[model samples]
Target: MIGKLNHVAIAVPDLEAACITYRDALGASLSQRQELPEHGVTVVFIDLGNTKVELLEPLGENSPIAQFLERNPTGGMHHICYEVPDIRSARDRLLAEGARVLGDGEPKIGAHGKPVLFLHPKDFCGTLVELEEV
Candidate 1:
């Protein structure tokens, strides 16, 4: 079941520059930053009140964000992640509804060590859907 609205991820080419804008300029504090080699990207989190704004920078050409950035030259919001009580069940529900997954099966390592699965945006009205177990 989808629980809470988690952090909104924004794709950016420069994580450091984005962090400075959100932190020093916008008054949001840097929460955390992590590099996921498997995903080929680096993420920096900025706490904004109760929610967090995540900045994503592609580590290489194979990174999902790299493709995103290439398409959107301005670099904007990439995807929204919703917290779920049980990711496996959530994914099952989505798949039963004819939603396609990027991977063959099972949850994968996500930002902040969360287990996550994605539902094809095309099946969900072009909104990229990410399910994370909190």
Candidate 2:
């Protein structure tokens, strides 16, 4: 049902600061910043050898990341994404297993421009799970 770990997402109060920390402190290479308006986030991806880390900042007041930051002003891990060969098929299987999909239970275009779905945290040991079609 899950493939490789795609990326780990962290909500940050300041995206640039987070980028600087990863770049200067960790000496990590980063991808260009991207604004995902539909998802209401500004993101930067830090590439590691086998996986990636995503830093997210709220793009607007209504952004979910903003709400997350409200609860955690310092920001923290928001979700972890996993690759799936077939998103819809994976979604269906998760559904059959009684896992609740977030939103409309339909896949949405994610930060990687791939079909992605989020599962309820309560169903996944209090960790928000994101499935991205590889």
Q: Could you list the CA RMSD of all candidates, in the order they appear?
A: 1.5, 1.0
TM-score of each: 0.90, 0.95
> Largest lDDT belongs to which candidate?
2
Clashes of each: 0, 0
Worst 10 residues of 2 by lDDT: 60-69
lDDT of 1 by residue, 35-133 (tens): 877888888887777777788899866898787898997689888888998888888888798879877769997866889988788887788888889
Compared with the true structure, the alpha-carbon lDDT of candidate 1 equals: 0.83
- Model 1 CA deviation exceeding 4 Å by range: none
Q: What is the lDDT of residue 112 in candidate 2?
A: 74
Residue-level lDDT for 131 in candidate 1: 83
Residue 125 Cα positional deviation in candidate 2, in Å, after optimal superposition:
0.6
